[model samples]
Target chain A: MSSYNWAPGFIDDGDRAQIVTSRFQYEDGHTLDRYLATGGYAGLKAALARTPTQVHEEVKAATLLGRGGAGFPAGTKWGLCPEGKWPRYLVVNGDESEPGTYKDRLLMERDPHQLIEGCLITCYAVGLSQCFLYVRGEMALAQERVAAALNEAYAAGYIGRNILGSKFSVDIVLHWGAGAYVVGEETALIESLEGNRGMPRLKPPFFPAAIGLYGKPTIVNNVETLANLPWLLTHSAAEYMAIGTPTSPGTRMIAVSGHVRRPGVFEIINGTTTFRDLLYGDEFCQGIRDDNELKAFVPGGGSAPWFLPDQLDLPFEAKLVGAAGSMLGSGAVMVMDETTDIPVAALTLARFYAHESCGKCVPCREGATWLERIMERLVDGHGTENDLDQLLEIGQTICPGPFPHAASERLGLAAVPFPFKMTTICFVGPSAYTPVHSAVTLFRSEFEARIVKRKLIPVSIGASDE
Target chain B: MTRLNDANQVLAREIIGRYPKARSATIPLLHVAQQQNGYITQEAIAHIAELVGATSAEVLGTCTFYEMFKMHPVGKYLINICTTMSCALMGAEQLVTHAEQRLGIKAGGTTPDGLFTLERVECQAACTEAPCLQANYRYRYRVNAAQLDQFLDDLAEGQLDAEIPAHGVVARVRQSIPVDRAVSVVAPDDVHEAPVWMPLSGTTA
Candidate 1:
């Protein structure tokens, strides 16, 4: 099989038998034996050797960021917990349900031992005795694989009391979430884990590090993020950091789907590869299968804003994407070719966000539904000038605005800041606005043509929607 | 026959205990019921409703919301086709047609031999390998009409008798065939009885 240079040292060996990990090279089926062979439980063993403070410092030095949406540094979050807190829980957010995102599913299903190893390391780092792997409910097979791996760890003395004859002890629990897009959010995940409707809670007082699952100190890390812990512990942080960009180190699993010749998940070093490299440089994604021109791309799943083809040169890093007014949200790159109608595609995504909105926030609930309805009307050729304005208005409403002037004034405070200023405030509402704004700005002519012609002019699927 | 095996009862109680209000356990209870019994019969749903203190309609509403919960009887092997945009674009229709033709049944219909049940579903997030299907919860991605044929053949001939490979994006046949033939066997007690169809409210059709 042909191998691609995904990064400086990492290569897509295309080996079906070997499991992909930073330190270990285990054959596919012998996960338990091979994992043990490669000093897999060494991190847990090392963590068990030290105090929780030492473990926390080691992780903090590694600077591992959560591989889920919002790449917050994992160690920093863990260090923020109050001392002497009992029952600190580590939640493995395995709810990999993001559209165009399938990397976590592959990791959880293929090399579950790696994830369990990482979870154990994390539990020891935070002085937590119990950890929960909160997988999406639909992933029955993945859940079973994880459960089997956990059982294997328990049987092999990698988990449970005095793991590896050390003083540390931890137990892993598997919790499946009712399928919902909102449940992927940290607060919403906590709610769902608590067996409540998966609605996101307001921040400030309820941050997961302070008060989380069962109202105790909790840290929720993504599957892929936790999967990196064992490797980080086994190898020096500098060795791992040598692979990727300074800001975003290590390999990121990029899931490329939609209108590609070969669509699958591949792990690429954070800044070494570009969109074109993933999409066009290989026989796998042989550049728009049907000779269609590329229109636009969702750099990160359906939630992230659309990026014009020109922006493909931008580094595939979260910080860089955020600088470009888009997010590397979940690393779900959805490529849309020319044949796709921008209005129709936008309407479809809008409809999804609207349907999945938990109805807890007024702006997101009402605004997203209105945007979907209006965009649907516009796409179907029933758009009026008023409808276009209404669509824009709804998009603005969903974009977190400052509190109303009257409310701010009544509170005797300075002018209220825009909702976008609060980094952790509401990512969903702003995320919902990205595609809408992009569709309007980049495809103004298309929208205008649809309105004037009152019909869709089909373009090549690979042609630019703009 | 086992009067709710220990595992099933434990699963039921465990799911119910997760919720603060016992009434919130209706949906998961119905799922457990369906998993225990091949399909959620009216009696099973009623029993769940009584257990969770929910009306039948309320329980039914929860059941109908998720596509996984089966309201009616399915064949021994359930084949769920992906009908979402990504799969549709990759000729999921052809795969569905091929399945129907090979199985001699429609998309939502079961085989006359009561061996296979095919249904259309929304996106399975395996769009990278578009045109995928889930047979008994194991994903079969990058599927075409011919691959489906090979899979059906392997399944029919009982050649597939290993644990399904848990990961990757390749097109391969996966099987978790039950070890005990007695446990895996789906015996038809009688054939003369009318084909029982549950209300479509809880089903994708």
Candidate 2:
């Protein structure tokens, strides 16, 4: 979307079924004229023709899952809004600050009208009057484009009062965040929307659908999640459901980063596409960079645990990935080459969580910082075998129980599947420990070697010349 | 150091009017305050508090929670080189080291000339272009050592002045929604009945 020189395979190929990124290749793609010329607001028009309840039913039938990390079905989330709550709101989460994730930023920047159209359809279906488009602050282009698009849509009568003579009227407001990753969480997003510190409220009593922005019923959706509505409404639910695997239908945009020959964002088949296809397929990354063998890869975003080469053939399904002890969160697959130092990589991720921990919960704030400190000491060659145990112990304090990890089987620890038990308020606590757990358990020898050296180890991860 | 001037105050008032509650404009108003000053000042915080009907302490509380809202002043050109895992895996650390030596300042330090400020940041979501950096939140991708030097040289020479703005200037365009254009701004307490589509209580689906 930033016109980076990297060529994604799907962009050139005509065979691929790209729903969200169909208009990405064209110049002036973000403009309303291009959007209208290329069948942009047809979904909203079609949605306006049907009853709001009927539109809701159609999306429910499609079973569209939230693409912003958690795989919660969007339709199910919409129904959770109280039946009689008036002036309900729809909040679109564009706060895509995850380490390996950049697809949502592209969605907001390249095809903002598609997202706006999606928001219109969603607000119409869910009986909501106002929608907030909360984008991350760092994305200057995305904010400008979306704000410009909103002005266009308002002028064109696509947004605002009584759209095209339909009785439904909606107001779409664009709000941007100052810089926080934990705000990506729904409740935290709601809090930030209310001009408070971006902290996750305790659930049950504080669900967004029940008590949301300004203490009214609200539906917070991701940019991609709402972006799917345009396509899903344009076609039948059955037709939408037929593209990918039954459970995980529709194409997913995966931002493949780290050591790869052709690293870029690719829209692959949802559940059927495997890590092998993504990392090595000719239509995808082509292969690892510089003919290097793959060492490990982060299946989801930075929060996901590391996956070994043996699990490369597993499908990109949520349930399947979760069964393997990591969730395909945020669709950010980071490929690590054989040259990668596992401890250093883990520390990098640990420091990210430490810096991002909002300090709302003690475990995430204190435990994550301590984890980074220990990992930093270990990577700097001043650690001992005891420090490795201390890392796990600190991780245990965040996520309770015999934590199931990437190397749990080899470590003789119980390999219980994910939805890992947590002691903190949100997943940010466990996310800090994910890297430490996966790296230490899977590559204990590397960490041990660093500890034994007792001297600063020269990092030789990647060559810039390549 | 001064409060929002007449021009910025008009922009600030327009922003506060968009939200149903004035408190929701705190973040956006802070952005305006930052853009007016290089960084958010105590005077700007007090002005935003008066504008948004929140106390200065409350406004400061919200501003401090976010990383982007700098409490102290930064250099004219703030260079945030992302050294997180994905970026680090692609030689982001080496780039940071290169920048530190070249700029003669560590990650969180600004140059003595006050032209450049360097900081090791987390993910900026440009992972595919590994080892990316943001100069005033405008992205520079796949930066090698030479390109970094060229960028710095270009910045110092004012060659890239038109392309990139100062630290707090995120976007030049401000979002404006006219009063007539707004669908409805009825407060939550005033609304009682659900939409025609939503079934009322004790009614079948």
lDDT of 2 at A362: 94
Q: Write the per-residue lDDT of candidate 1 for residues A1-466, one digit (tens) a residue.
A: 2212210112244422122343323334326876677666676666666665566677677677778988888888887766545456687888876767777776776678889888887776666656767877667667777777766777777766666766566556666554577778887887666545677888776468788876777788999888887777766677767777777877787777778776766777676678887788662366887878888887877777667667677777766666565677788888888887777767656766666677777878777777877787788788876776677677666653432110112223332222243223456666555566667766766887777444557668776867
lDDT per residue as tens, model 2, B1-205? 3799999999888888888988899999999888988899999999999998999999999999998999888999999999888899999999999999999988999998889989899999989887999999888998999999999999999998887998889977656776666776777778777754444451211
C-alpha DockQ of every model: 0.09, 0.60
Tell me the TM-score for chain B of model 2.
0.93
Per-residue CA lDDT of model 2 for A1-466, tens digit only, reads 3243422222334267778888888757899999999998999989988877788889889989999888888888888887666778899999998889988888887899999999999888888878999999988888988999999989888888878877778889999899999999999999898898899998666468888888888998999989989999899899889989889999899989999998878888899999998889887788999999999999999999888886788898988877777889999999999999899999999999999999988989999999999999899988887898999999989988866555344455544478878888888999999999999888889988887644667777777655
Second chain of candidate 1: TM-score?
0.71
lDDT of 1 by residue, B55-157 (tens): 7776665565444566777776778787544665567767888888888888889888777888876556686777888776677777888899998777666
Model 2 CA deviation exceeding 4 Å by range: A1-14, A407-415, A453-466, B196-205
Considering only chain B, report the TM-score of each candidate against the true chain B: 0.71, 0.93
After best superposition, candidate 1 residue A282: deviation in angstroms? 3.7
Q: Can you tell me the CAPRI class of model 1?
A: incorrect
